[model samples]
Target: MYQFAITGLYQQVLGGEKLNQIEKTGELTSSRFTVRDFTELVKIGIVNSNTITAFTGMWLAFQLNGISFIQNVDVIFFTIVGSALIVAASGAFNNVIDRDIDGIMERTKNRPTMTGKISGKRALMVALVLGVVGTIMLFMTTWQAGVLGVIGVFLYVVVYSLYAKRKLVSNTVIGSFSGAVPPLIGWFAVEPSFSIVPIMLFLVMFCWQPPHFYAIAIKRKEEYAAAGIPMLPVVKGIERTKKSMFFWVILLTVLPFFMFDLGLVYVILATLLNIGWLALSIYGFKMDDSIKWAKWMFVYSLNYMTILFVAMVVISIFL
Candidate 1:
């Protein structure tokens, strides 16, 4: 009996250790998933690639001004990080505000906010911290940049997402204003002067967004309509939005010419990019399966902006 008791106790202790190990393993997995979810949530909110592009345009614009590398390195660090954080914060706030409506939209229904991957309260806290810290960092570089960052947050969260998004057909236009501000923030970070180049950059983004977003809106028309979102395509019909997109693309094409500082390289590239975009828009307008065309336009717009900005950087560096 004593021997049996000893064996049972030993088995129990071993089992207990195994259980503890399993618990630890489970906890480690949980921690990893949480970290991943948090990262995904940030990306979903900020649209990091687009944010980086806008920030890059600003940084390149500063470089074009002939600022020293040493001075620029630190400024680039603070400005990009701070601006990106603020953009993230704005995106998080948007997710929180739109969580309900987001659930109804097929494309947005699977988002962290919709799927409860992260709690809304936790998301808000993250946004607040990012916004405050980022704004402080931005102010360390330039007060103008900090202010522009704040304006971007307010416009995205309050003006565009909360007020305009549901109520106005011009919601894309309102949202574009926030998108355009990132480059301006970058521009003013180095050159506080309100110049034509920065304004043109802003206009380029502004014009680009309508077509970009309208294309998405067209592709997802039924979703927007079902979700009760007043997107241009949902409200204005496909043909109208297509016409609007072409008009914006034309404007985007012409605007770069006025930026004489951009030189032949940028002008040539911008012309090509706009022609392709304009041709695609015109084709979509005439196509029977306009949704497919819209999708093509959407993809092209992403490539268009990326190439245009890179061209801006290259010209700024070489010419």
Candidate 2:
């Protein structure tokens, strides 16, 4: 009975019209892997974004701890490169785990995993290699950062992807923990201790993810529903998702105040960014087209994180 049910599900997912479309597009045909395929498999964009935050944290740590970057260039190199590798590994693992659903979502339907450009076993091998090397590199910096890297991978691959992602509406929230760990890893690589600065940075990333992801959920509600993923927007409705986004944005607004060490420039810029995001969230309540509003929110969230993290590095350098 279980076998039959599994077969039925696969048939629904990969048979008939969808199969025709896959065949027509040559998506199911095995092909030689290319650099573009590798980038997609590892989700280079996500790696780059997370690496930026990690770099920001490391830079701030150097500034706050009065350490010379010239003296600790090795640590900086390892931390940045290791963070990127771990994040990329996580993305590859996610692609392997999510290939079934990836084929169903328009945005993800062309992923290397779904297109037969990279086999699942090969992807897993790549993930393992990247994760091991990344963890070792992090350990070369500090045990604290190494431990955080392992924790981040576990949260992302096991806790979020294997568990919460399909079973709970709070999956995005759960996944944010892993996403927030990069900066912590960076700080720990330099300082190897807990402090307000790193904690505030973690909180900044933590509070930023929900609203950012909720916007994606809203924009792709139908796909999420079809994929059987219980995203907040798909399960609870867009209005509820909007309210939640606002709540998170509100929480995010106060986090900057706690990091007064970042200087007045960071504070003001962060405050303005928060206000702009809050205003955008409020405007969502009035927008007739929720999809358009979600797109705006998603774009703003990207800009918000990029600008805020870059500003942190710049402020740490001059201030």
Candidate 3:
């Protein structure tokens, strides 16, 4: 009688499995991303803390060139938002194109597209939305701002990402133009006219990129080689890349002397910053071809740019 009762109870429990399956079926759901995931995507999109420097530099340029713009919050909003979104769009689109190669490199192996967190098609769609919306914001500021914004996008996406990055050894040069345009967009959103100072701003950023990028290329040459991207260090050899870096460092050191309107403080500050950078570049060669030195130069370059631009803003305001 006990055995019979136990068997009956087990049969009832077996039937409860059907109810459990029904409950689970009702609870079925798709994967949902967390806040942290969106944050990572933003980082991948290049809309992180570092972008403050770029946006601030542009805003400072606008303020210095046209002080009245500081009173116009709408223009300020458009310039900051438009420039950032365009940068994000460019980075996302580049990630989409470089996904395959990115997966092969240790440095880029865990990018969203590589890790399947974001599909390439999805990334492309995101880029499109960002680009279009950013352009619209800039248009609200001024048509010239909108035009420069679109040109920046085209240069980064088409000229650099699609063409030069894969085919030409001068990819860094081509890419620098896109990087340099944000300040011009900021300046023109208010000034709406061409000036030598804005052109000098563009040239400063343009000259700053080659040595900065090549230092990174030197540090990661093996990864770049494995990915089959002809970064300067990979195609031209590290020694030659170092010499090229040195040449740019020297040019970067001197470019500030011409920005006379930025005043003597800017000239002195920029000169001191570049001299430190130049010292790093020369010290790297003297350090017996150390990758450590390349790594140091890479880190120093970040500080160099931020400080140099901060000096521009300070001199423009206080001096």
Candidate 4:
């Protein structure tokens, strides 16, 4: 349903350079997918596919917790489906909102939008479908879980796509809410209980997003500036962005000790992870920052968050 809509929306909404590419290629030889055919795919949720795949790696972390039985068949099932839907919806919305800007940027120029594989109306429908389904499925877990799903959708779609992303300054802060929900989703999945620990995980992600995005923004500062998008590197200097990244890495690393009753294993591992990030940031600050360096940090950040959350589950096991 969304395949066509996303593509249509992209081409009509954003008059990108890729259109010429398509024109030159004369459609038949072009590598890009067409709007009509792509939309027809029943398996429309690539976001769902990736989310479920990543969740598997992180799922065991929850199992390690002393709780012994974090994996209720129902809970895992619902969490995957819920998160998948939300993630898919958010991805669709992101494509919809950034259709024009994405076309403007070389890196994003090949997205469904730029390729004319989907339309605005269709893309919006896809987003609504995934967003609604994801939220509804959360009800299978608990009302709170359902609400979390809703919050994730709202944060990504409204706060990030509509509000923060365009404004450029502090947009990453607003977008971070969407990224921060994963741990809470996992926490709520089993416990359905609230505590400072889960909140701390949430805060860690919130702090982590800026630096992660700043690194990317710095690397792609030209692309963003050309699109009139206000990334930190473009708005503030790269040095300032590095300094900000350092501040968050420091705070996020130190924050866990205060919020969770972590033992030495968890504490040491998390601290090491934080320090590692801070070290990278320091290096990024000292040298003329490179895209390669930023990419490394970005990849490491993914590993760091996954590791930290898994470690939390482990600490909970022995306690």
lDDT of 3 by residue, 112-168 (tens): 655555654456667789888989998888898899888988888777876688788
* TM-score to native of every candidate shown: 0.87, 0.91, 0.85, 0.79
For model 1, what is the alpha-carbon lDDT of residue 217? 92
Candidate 2's C-alpha runs over 4 A off are: 1-31
Q: What is the C-alpha lDDT of each candidate?
A: 0.76, 0.89, 0.73, 0.68
User: Candidate 3 vs candidate 4: which has greater lDDT?
Assistant: 3
lDDT of 4 by residue, 19-130 (tens): 4355455551334445543433222444533353325323533543444444467777777777777777777777767766776798877666556666544566777887
lDDT tens digits, residues 25-128, model 2?
76664668899999999999999999999998899899999999999999999999999999999998888778768878999999986777776656777888
Better of 1 and 3 by lDDT: 1
Candidate 1 C-alpha lDDT tens digits along 1-319: 3464334323322224433354345421232226656666566434665566657656666677777757578778888888888878877777666665676787777666545456555566787898999888788778998898888887887778667888899999889999888888888777777877888888998889899999889988998999899999888898899899999988988997888887877788888888888888788757999988988998998888878887787678777
Q: What ranking emerges by lDDT with the best candidate at the front?
A: 2, 1, 3, 4
What residue pairs are clashing in model 1?
none
Clashing pairs in 2: none
Q: TM-score winner between 1 and 4, please give it.
A: 1
What are the root-mean-square deviations of the candidates from the true structure over C-alphas?
13.2, 4.7, 14.3, 5.8
Worst 10 residues of 4 by lDDT: 37-46
Model 3 lDDT at residue 55 = 60
